[model samples]
Structures are given as structure tokens and as C-alpha cells.
Target: MMMKTIKYASLFRSEAKKVHRSKRWKPIFNEPLPIEVTGSTQYQGLAPFDFVVALLQDGQSLPSYFYVHPLTLPRKTRANIARALNKSVNEVQCLELHFDGHNGDHLLVYSSDDDANILYLIAIGTHSDIFG
Candidate 1:
């Protein structure tokens, strides 16, 4: 597997550090949302995905939950993204992906559940699963 770079927001890094220091999972899970994807995310750059990949790509399995400010991505055709993620679009925000150790993963390709295909871009992972 190609190793993608992981760039963490300062706030998230700090929060992670604090959580580590606190010696607990609840604290980490309770952390406020991470930075909003702005200028960088506008270009369809893989940065957002890369960040998530970096966060959980190690041999160990760690679940991560993220929130994205919704963006309408009609231009982001399902076919193209499916080709990229190597998965098929199940519904508006649902797609199937097989990521090495992470199986049965669904990409809320864009977070909004509405019909406009608004991509609120978020990846969720829990104790038994990962959504990156």
C-alpha cells in the first residue's frame, strides 16, 4: 500500500495530545470538530482523504470520526469517484470500499443526506470499524 502523508490540524494535534495525556478514549472522542476544509479542499485535492488515511493507516486498527461542512458536488459524478475509490455508489452518500484491513466500509462520499448530493465529506470509524 502506498503511504500517504498525514497532516493534522494544530487543534486536533493538541486535542490528541491532551487525550493521550488524559489516558482515556472518551476525551478523544469528545473533542470538538477538526478544522474546516476550505481553499485546500476546493481543488478536489486528495488532502482531505489523505489526512484521514494518515490518521488510521497504521497496522493497528483505530476508528476515527470526522465532520465536514457540506458542499454541493454535482460536478463530482459518482462514476468518477467510484473509479477513484474503486467502489460503487450505493446511494447518494453511500458507496462500498475495500481498504485492506478495513472492509465493508461505506463512504458517505459527501455527508448530506439530501438529494442534491451535497458532500459534507466525513469519515467515521468506531471500535469495530473504520470509515476512511
Candidate 2:
């Protein structure tokens, strides 16, 4: 069965709680590169979906970086993103991350229950390429 996509705001809240409670942010290497997760809110960009920045770390003092949340994108777009990242669609969906071939930022893409044809894309990187 397909996993139900929760609200973008709700997911952000849950991730914040998890990060604060566990204080752990593990980086997952997406083949040939390391994708760091951060909770910093200093990112400035316009996204297609509602998103928030959250830090990922093991403690309060050391913050590796920040990651954006609640990215719901379309399947075709997802596929294109997956290919760009040298990843499979399932990997992209399961991990909530995508590499735009530049910079270091954690990106998220989630499906929308209200609109099956739409997928939310959230990230803390420059939106000139994607949004343009």
C-alpha cells in the first residue's frame, strides 16, 4: 500500500519534534555525494509548496546544516529530479531528498492527497533554476 502523504505543516512539526527530541541528524550519501540535513532557517527562496527549515544535529552546539520540508512534486517532475540525482523514484520518495547538481542543501518532495497529480517540492536552495 502507498503511504499517505500528510500535511506539509504537520510534517514540519513532526520533524521539528523528532530533531529536538532525538537530537540526531544523520547524513545519507546519495551516491557520489553526501546529502546533509540541517535545521537552519537562514535560507531565502520561493518554493512551489509550503516549507520550513530545520536543523539536523546530535546536540545543541554542533549543527551540521539545515533541511527543508514538505515538498510535494509531480511524478514526471519527480522522475526528472530522480534521474538528475542518479537515484530511483522510490529512493527519492523514500528519502525525501534530491540534488539539483549544485550547492549543498537538503530537499524534500512529497505527494499531495488532495491532488494526486501534484507533488510538493521544498528546499532551502536557490530557486532560480527550479522555480524559473
Candidate 3:
């Protein structure tokens, strides 16, 4: 199966800037959004990467669309996040993170493949740890 690359990483900076610039920045939901899915087209689950993009893009409608799934950040996004956290990209294996669709405090737990049980959590966007 060919994997289609999602460009959410590149958009992260811009989205962050928008969020930082305006306290009242609301996402426009009028545009049709693209969401990725797994398995048969008819029977599929939400793609984690796509879901993150949707969250970063517009979160107003997340309750209707986003869900808890195994989310893997793309290579580019992983690298970007590593840089943001001041971590060495090679030492960080953070492609996978969890979003329960109800929490605003998204925890990005990065596990180092070189070492087991070594986890780092970087909080992004808004919300506290509601998943716990």
C-alpha cells in the first residue's frame, strides 16, 4: 500500500503563528476538509495524521469528526517537534502520539527507540490533561 504524505507539519508553524497572534483566532469551517482513512473505503477509521491536521486547522467541529486513534506524525513533523523541544532528531522517536478526541491538552509522548521506557511529553495547543 502506497502511503500518501500529509503536509500538516509544514502548516504547523503558520497555524501556531495564527494562534499566537490573535486571542480570538477562530478556524474557518466553511471549506471542505480532507480526512484520511484506513482499510476499505467504506469501512475505515480516521487517519491520525489527517485528524491532527483537522485539529490544527479548525477545532470547532472536532467533536463531530475527530476520534481516538493511533496517530503517527510524519517524519517532517517529528523533526519539527524535536527541534521545538530542543531534542536531537536522531534520539527522538516521536512519530506516534495519542489524542482521545475529548482533551484539549494534547500530550505528545516521544519514546526513544534506543532506550525503552524513556518518554517525554510535550504539550501543544490548549487544554489540560483531560485524558488522565
Candidate 4:
């Protein structure tokens, strides 16, 4: 009998860790935008990364050839987020970070459901995190 391939979600745990360590800077804006944090996919439980990428790309309507997912994020750091999505890092107080999409870009979006524990991203940037 042939066996089927099972996708284990465990491998992603480490990738997820990389995101958390990254610092989420406060947006330059004086006020916080009306955004929420979540763990559910914003796109009806489908892939929500695209929506996030759109917002990150200055809210472009066109589709992209790549898939972006959020591995981790801190609170209220949306301004420099564009750089993080691109898998590049920003420096402040001598710190660099990466967005671990498990080999894909990352985005932040809102989820309709409300039972999630982790925060949700509505966009991504060109930043990558390393050693913190």
C-alpha cells in the first residue's frame, strides 16, 4: 500500500520563533491605526498572506507571483514593516531582524474570527532578523 505525504506543522515552530525575537517598532505616526491582532487566516481561513502583501506594497490591487506569510511580529510597528516583509532587516540600537515566512514573504492582516492567540499582520516589509 502506498502512503500519503503528511505535512507536519512542527518544522515551522522554529521559523515562528525567529519572528517573535524581532523587535516591532512603533510607527512614526502619533496615533495607532484601527488594527487587530489574531492567529486565524484573514482570508476566510484561506491564505491571508496575499492581502497582507497588498497592504505592504502600499495597498496595490495587483496580484504577486510570491506568497508572503507572517512568522512573528511585535506590537505597533507598522511603519518600517514594509522592509521586514522583504526579508531584509532594519537597524535601531544595533539590532537586525528577519521575517521568517518559511522561505516566503510575510504580511499582516485581520481575521474575522476572534479565538486566536497570536497577533495578525496586515502587511510585510523588507526586513530580516538575526540573533534577536
TM-score of each: 0.24, 0.24, 0.24, 0.20
**Per-residue lDDT of candidate 2, residues 1-132 (tens digit):** 232333333444454344334322223221222224223334223121222211111112212223323455668766765564456776555224333322443344333322232233332222432344
What candidate 2 gets wrong by more than 4 Å, as runs, is 1-67, 93-132
lDDT of 3 by residue, 1-132 (tens): 122222234344444454445443232112222333232432134344344443333322233334433445567766875674456766555433334334423333333322222223333343332123
Write the residue-wise lDDT of candidate 4 on 8-107 in tens digits.
1222344445444555322211222222321333422222333333233333221233333234435334323323332223321111112223353342
Question: What residue runs in model 4 are displaced by over 4 Å at the alpha carbon?
Answer: 1-6, 24-62, 65-132
Question: By the TM-score metric, which is better: model 1 or model 4?
Answer: 1
> Best-fitting candidate, measured by lDDT?
3
Off by over 4 Å in 3: 1-10, 13-66, 90-132
Candidate 1 lowest-lDDT run of ten: 104-113
Which of candidates 3 and 4 is the stronger one according to lDDT?
A: 3
Candidate 1 has a TM-score of 0.24
Cα lDDT, model 3, residue 71: 44
Worst-scoring 10-residue span by lDDT in model 2 = 53-62
Candidate 2: RMSD to truth: 14.8
Instruction: List the global CA lDDT of all models.
Output: 0.33, 0.34, 0.38, 0.29
Error of 4 at 127 (Å): 9.9
Query: Candidate 1: where are CA atoms >4 Å away?
Result: 26-132
